[model samples]
Target: MDGTMSGVGIDIRDDGLARVTLRRGDAGNAIDLTTARGLLDAATACERSGVRAVLLSGEGRSFCVGGDLREFARFEGEALEQHLLAVTGALHEALRVFARLDAPMVAAVQGAVAGAGIGLAAAADVTLAADDASFTAAYTGIGYSPDAGVSWFLPRLAGPKRALDLLLTNRRIPASEAVEIGLVSRTVAAGLLADEAARTAEVLRDGPAGAFGATRRLVAAGLTADLGPHLDREARALAAAARGEEGREGVAAFLGKRPPAFRSAASPF
Candidate 1:
């Protein structure tokens, strides 16, 4: 599948890799209502297609600059409130779908990543930012609170205190600092960002899909699960994986001193 939905582009390859790109480069990929709906549509397609991996990126200098204030400025009072609600509702639902996916997501961000952009980047299992990238929590600066899971993800990724500092102060941090604070996975040269992101997504696509899904669920559950119960969950997951076809292939490959063919051995979701 290859098409553009509003300002979002969806390209799903035969190799089970989905590329979702923010296509409104001239508008800084801002999340207008149409863009929000487009994102949800793209995410839904990926889930339905059972894509093994997703790569999210932007087409221009900046990944995204957050909500389109210019569009919001057109409304007032109840109209503005209604408009924002629709925007956030769709955007949040898109994030929820992406989070629940068995496939992993990789975000390649460059230039400005602010507000909702930060949330989108943080939502990824792995986020690769260009060395020239900059991040900021622009919500407070605009007299608006956060949407797009920014409030939820930041506290977990960067710690509560750091998250608050960024949110309250609206400070812009470089990609290096973002990595240091755990806001991003790593920073690559601007020119290498696309290749690195594609490489990472391809690696994930070629991995054991079932095992990867289990691992993703485990980590997300572990974040809030109690130690004892989490261990039990882990045990159950491990046993199931060990009894599956991928497990047998992996063991056989090890004994034969050969790389495992996880993609071929794994079952469909």
Candidate 2:
């Protein structure tokens, strides 16, 4: 991805994971209009490429400090809201696309994750962080309300009280504390974090793809549809999955008391 001016350095690897890196290392990998636009393209590219999952990371030491303040100089009267809407609209679109997939997303967060950076991380299905990483909201400190998905994602992941405290106080939380408060999935050793995340993602990718997707839909059902429709959807999906080859293999393995092979199976099974 060529976003030199934007500083949104996106690299898509053929290993079935795209890395959307914020590259403004000088300013802590801050997001700018160009960067946000680049991010929009990157998200589209990932889905278009059919990657099972994307691994969001940073190129430099910092994940993303926040939106670029230098660009703040360009802000005009009514254009302010329009500009924010333009870029953040891209962010929400990306989140919507990523949310549709059941492939487990693993965010490898390190260094500082502040402001909109938290939104990006929360968009992922799972997050893996170094024990030393730090997370902060920092929006109010700079005279802005949370523009990212913080309002929607944070409270659910980290719990209402913790999310409220962080957003209101603009406080920074250590990665260890984040784990304790449910902000991150878990803390890993600095050097092994990437490998650990990869292992987890592999486990997900190797599992029953349709079933996994259906499971995700079931779990997230509570956010919208009611009990009757929810159960109907769940039953339909589960039945479909159970009728497939993976389900047959799983059942055979259970009866035989042996691990059945999944990587190879008969067609239309």
Candidate 3:
């Protein structure tokens, strides 16, 4: 694996899986400006590395506790405003990059997921929470607004009404309820998080990357765009994929009754 460590740790393995870890365990992986920059850097690196899948997780008791209150407490007035602007800029860029990337993203979450942590989980294509995991939109309690795409993804995932409930009330929802409400893809035992995430990542990494990427973009666009334009977009994407090497291999594999070799040297993603 090719690895780098900072506030965020990125390890791009041989199988083209990028493992992104939030490294601030002692601090519940809270995002300070520096950590936000690290996140952006890690995401940029993932795009540049041509990885086929991404696995995001935090290193400790919680996935993340959101913005570092201690860090925020240090600034005042204009200084505070500028600091927050810079922090959110970096954080948003990272999430945008991951969302637009060809590689699919999966998150393994445990412990507390609060504030911007909810954004992270929402942003992932699939999120697997440990049974002990809990989610809370802690922004209102702290007299802050949502950031890190929480306002965007949450409304779509849980519907505007339910999303408002979480955003306004700051009520804590455990993994089971999160799943019931579609806030998370599913829940697993805490001990199974790593293995399940890894397995899911591997499956995505070995799949038809181009098709997966196109489908992801389509889904995201469908949420906002009208049907006619969306259909045009889908048609173009399908035609493009059908002309690609991966598409040819998928068809050939089916005819041959064999698994598709999406990772072959000449494969198109």
Cα RMSD for candidates in order: 1.2, 3.4, 1.4
**How does residue 48 of candidate 3 score in lDDT?**
87
CA shift of 248, model 2, Å? 3.3
Candidate 2 lDDT over residue span 24-56, tens digit each: 777887877777877777777766765555677
> lDDT per residue, candidate 3, 18-105, as tens digits?
9999999999999998889988988998888878999999999999989999999999999999999999999999999999888999
lDDT of each: 0.94, 0.75, 0.91
Q: List the residue pairs that clash in candidate 3.
A: none
* TM-score, per-candidate, Cα-based: 0.98, 0.85, 0.97
Which residue pairs clash within candidate 2?
245-269
| Stretches > 4 Å off in candidate 1 | 267-269
List runs of model 3 lying over 4 Å from the truth: 265-269
| Candidate with the greatest lDDT versus the true structure | 1
Cα-lDDT of candidate 2: 0.75
The best candidate in terms of TM-score: 1
lDDT of 1 at 118: 98
